[model samples]
Target: MSTQVAPTSGSPSRMAQLRQVFFSSPIVAFASLMLLLIVLAAIFAPWVSPYDPTRLAPATRLKPPSELNWLGTDAFGRDLFSRVVYGARISLVVGVGAAVAAVLLGLAVGLIAGFFRALDAILMRVVDGLMAIPNILLAIAIVALSGASLWTVLIAITIPEVPRVVRLVRSVVLSAREEPYVEAAMAAGSSTWRILTRHLLPNTVAPLIVQGTYICASAILIEAILSFLGAGISPETPTWGNIMAEGRIYFQINPGIIFWPGLVLSVTILSINLVGDAVRDALDPRMAKRGIDR
Candidate 1:
């Protein structure tokens, strides 16, 4: 009798694992859906928005929400809804850009500092000094010196974030470098570059993914704060913070002016944070061992 070969093991695939982690948690699922919708709205802002975000109509200025003007008009009669839709683009861009830049720069600096004992002291002292100053203060200083704009704001946000990423990466590398596989590779006369990239780098990926989400959420909040304080992009740009700042004076007249943007901003930030938390838990080895839903 012919018999089929038995499988060596039965384990869920990567995609199955992802689905289980993301979809099994009600809060995470809801948050992910909200975030996805916001991103889609931002990407299709031109089509999704009913009116030009910058269009002016003094007659329609400060008009309440209605069929014609869904989210109502600002002081300039620019459609608040449109401006908010566009604002998502600005916020997400800054958050993602700052996180990516910080991570890349931090990874390089961290790898070098961690691997080379001679440079660790010099690099970490600088990181410590940067970390000593508050994040917002450092961001503000950088923005002031560079002059406020998207690029400058990104740089401002990125500079302060880098130290944290660098420290995390450095610690990971320090521990990983001591592993037997690394030592074995070193003994085998592997190039430093190969040893670092092939071995040490892989070890940092899980932590970095989790760290990156936190950085993204933090960056989004910081960008909003900067814009609200008039230290961000130009006032003409319709970021959520700028929208709220412009409407603050007339809040009593129509709370929706500030209300709508503030709500969206809060939702966006909250969603990002929730997603980050879910990701962290899912990626935690201890949690994985315990099984997610349990």
Candidate 2:
């Protein structure tokens, strides 16, 4: 006679699993660290920056990197290091804010479209029309019409992002809505809202989270592009793109002006992209299991 052994639970807590996945790959760990440092620098810019980001010193114009000014001064004689530090705040705000707005709006549209056959055709046609337009072109048109400002730029960027998110969520919901549990919930006299929230919405979270990171990264890049093209926030605002735009004029004289901010922007985007990849892998059961088996 053989004695039966009870199966032990091996599943890890969410936080623990996330931590493990973050450190599983060295690139992911490094990216996360770099991203964290940039965020911290942005948050403490007012206190930690050596000089005022916007304050001009005509006497110090075009100065190179030195002990007095670590990253040197721009054409306006404002500290390059300080401007770059402060610029992080704008990038993060736009990226996060636009992504959140897009996701929430998309989620609502997607839920409605996926759940109801009548609305699906109408909503999908609208989504398709939006998708047909080039994202940057649409954003540029909106900004041009609305006049350039941070909020306008944010709205412009978000509008283009909504279609992609809506498509993703609608697909997920369409698939989930047909599942036995969801059908059972519907058949049991559950309200449409109740079935959506309880049965369909939860199924969309993982993919939405992954999609959100990509949206955030894309939003940051789009904001920078708009600013560079003079269609973003005010020129007076010391954003990364504005810094580069200002620096381009004096490119021959001092490349550091563009180099430093460009470097920061590139790294920040890369970090966000890397984190998104890690999150995708972590949230996917098949990917997680494959990683463990390997």
Candidate 3:
């Protein structure tokens, strides 16, 4: 005969569950710490930066990392460290702004398409058309048409991401709408709005959240690419992309110019991806069940 384990008050609280999920994967913990430090550095840039990122000094131009200038001065003699810090602000803003916009728009489209069978084909066809175009190329076209600026770049990045998000949400909603609870609500004469909002929307949150993190990470990388290609924010702006663009000319002279900012960007993206993976594993019921079994 087998003995059964009893549920008890010792079971973890919501916060404890989240903590455990975050720490269950060592990569997630390290990534979280790295992201936290980067965010803090970005937030405190104005105070922590030794010098103005954009203020140029010809006398100090091309200076290597030194006591006076931590990451050294760029070709324009602007502080590399300061520029990287300020660039973080731009990247994070674009990433988060684009992700939020895409998720909101995608959720609406997905809900309508998935809930109403009549609209599914047409809506999904449109989503398919959008997805057919390469993401970066679409963003470039949008940015080219709109003219490059912070907002334009954000919109450009967001538009390309929406289709992917919509597909993800639509698939989830399609499966969820057939569930017993959803059918029960439908048979009980629940209003379409109530059924969609009360039942369908809640189920999409976990996957949408996971997708959003990935979108945020993608947006950041896309923004950098756009800026580097001269299709992003103004060159005068001290974004990581523009900084690297400027640094490329002097790479033979001082590789540090490109190295530092590139390192930060890579680290930031990696950290976000790590956290996204952790969140996906945590929110997935199969994964959680497996963990419990283990």
lDDT winner: 2
Q: State the lDDT of candidate 1 residue by residue for 1-294, as single tens digits.
A: 999987535555445656788888888899999999999999999999998888889988999999999988998888899999999999999999999999999999999999999999999999999999998999989989889899999999999999999999999999999999999999999999999899999888878878888899899899989999998899999899899999999999889989998998888888988887877777676766667663
lDDT of 1 at 28: 84
What TM-score fits each model? 0.95, 0.95, 0.94
What stretches of model 2 exceed 4 Å from their correct place? 1-8, 291-294
Clashing pairs in 1: none
Q: lDDT tens digits, residues 1-294, model 3?
A: 999988666654445556777876677799999999999998999998988888989999999999999999999889899999999999999999999999999999999999889999999999999999998899999989989889999999999899988898899899999999999999999999999999999999989989999999999999999898888999999899999999999999989888998999999999999888877777777766566321
> Each candidate: what lDDT?
0.89, 0.92, 0.90
Better of 2 and 3 by TM-score: 2
Query: Per-residue CA lDDT of candidate 2, range 30-90, in tens?
Result: 9999999999999999987999888989999999999999999998799999999999999
Candidate 1: where is the Cα deviation over 4 Å?
1-13
Ranking of predictions according to TM-score: 2, 1, 3
**Candidate 1 versus the native: TM-score?**
0.95
Candidates in descending lDDT order: 2, 3, 1
Name the weakest run of 10 consecutive residues (lDDT summed) in model 1: 7-16
The residue-level lDDT of candidate 3 at 172 comes to: 86
